[model samples]
Target: MIVVALRARSSWHKPAWWATAFGAIAVATYGILWATPVVLDGMLGGRNLLTLVRDAAAVAAVWFFHNAVAAQQRKPEKKLPAWGLGLAVLSFTVPFLLISRPGPTSSAFVLDRLDQFPVWLFSSIYIFIVGALAARAIALLSSEKTVMTRFYVLGLSLMLVGSIIELMYLAATHFGPTNPDFRESLYYVAERPFFGGIFITVLGFLWVYAVRVFWKHLARWTLRIDARHEGGEYLARSLATSSENGWSDRQLAVNSAVNIRDRLKIGTQALSRREHALFSGVEHLLSNHLERTPR
Candidate 1:
């Protein structure tokens, strides 16, 4: 996640970097927030305000990554729906009002039942979108060769697996056996897989997103530098050949210098000032060598 943030800081223009950074941060933030929710709950004067915030952050992360992946495919950027954004906002801003319960069920159960709407809606949208995106990435893996593509596929796959496990936990709690013993057993059984999957999924995504952003520019820089070196080599060869022939062929020397100059310009702009100075030195040497030759 730190790597992704640094990459994004360097390349703000690329949509993928921004999206991946946001997604990585969102996951990390949620993990941190969830760790000491009780303290936050006390600080905020609420039982689960942080939980609601966490849900919204998760949804936002998914939305951002969807945009990132779509941008990578050269697809037209789709505007995010206002309603979805509004729902996330509402999840956080909605008043945490409590209604008096008059039944065998405890007050906590009543509150939990009431809490279902916002959390379920957020979870459903997040799960569905992530699942769809994962499938799309898998389909794309057959043809795309970029490092980003492979990592995206791997990251999405891990995320999908993690999401499925989480969904199973949610489903079991919401609709599975109601027996207290069964519920306790299920919770214990599901704990490791649920958290482990999330940890691995986020780790995979960090690699995918960070590599894509950094490697794209790194590869471009490498190619430019290599081409510049090759141009310099061509210039060196022209100077050597021109020098060896001496005054025997003045026209040939002139022609060789002109050829060297043209090739030297191929990627001259990519070089640093010091490298440019070196190129200029070579050019000067070539011209002087040609001039010294007798016509």
Candidate 2:
């Protein structure tokens, strides 16, 4: 993420910038998780606000990822209207705030709060948004033939599948099972694909960025070589033009050989006996033709 951010520092509107944002926000979401909800909840006033923040960050990261993919495909950089985004945020925030979080901050927030309506509401909204964006990304990348696009599609497909599994698990927990162990097992099963998908997606982005940088440097090197050998290149082109303009096959071959020799700075003495003999004969023949040509 830091590398991407540095590379994208020049332009805020490029696809790289959006990709950087996606990476950063995704990292932050997990950073919160790694900090442990107990610590974060206490710092944020103990209403499990960290969970809400984590879910919000996850949604934002996915949204940024969708934008990155769209921009990479050369789509218009249209963002969701501010009002719509605000309303969506409010929808999630209101439910979370209204729900009672009476006990000490639980490490297993999702499993413990599965029975709460607000928890279900928050989870449903997050899953739905993530699923939709992942599906859109898959659809966008399906038409692209690049290796990076294939990786992107595969990653997004995994994410979409994970979202579907999580939704189903949520429903089962509500309607089918009340057992804590069963819910925990189901949660892990559903969570693995999402994290795997994220890993693969970030890898794809970094790989593609590195490839682009390599090609850019290669192009610069070729351009420098072209500039340095301008005279040799011009001579080669002139010889080709003469050959195309009704020069005899013998004349063309001799001229092309001479051009190669001069371009490589090969001296007559450097030629092998047979090669020296052939060039001498061709030069003599060319001289005779030049002498006979009308002045």
RMSD of candidate 1 to the truth, in angstroms, is 13.2
Predicted model with the maximum lDDT = 2
| Candidate 2, lDDT over the whole model | 0.65
Per-residue alpha-carbon lDDT of model 2 for 1-295, expressed as tens digits?
5665676656666645655665575466444545655676787776667677766666666666676677666775543433654566677777777676634666577678879887777777778777887897787778888887888888888889998999998888866856888998989999889778877887887787676675444333323332334555654564457557955444454444444335435332244466446545544555643322111
lDDT of each: 0.50, 0.65
lDDT for 87 in candidate 2 is 61
TM-scores across all candidates?
0.51, 0.67
lDDT of 1 by residue, 1-295 (tens): 6666565556666655655565555555334545554554445555444554555555555555565555556554453453765665454444322222222222133224433544444444555555555555466454687775665566666666666765566565655546656555655454454355445545666676555545444333333444444664654554456458752233343354444355445634344576456445444545654332111
How high is the lDDT of residue 204 in model 1? Answer: 60
Stretches of candidate 2 off by over 4 Å are 32-42, 77-87, 102-106, 217-295
Candidate 1 residues lying further than 4 Å off, grouped into runs, are 1-21, 24-36, 77-83, 88-151, 161-172, 175-177, 188-201, 209-295
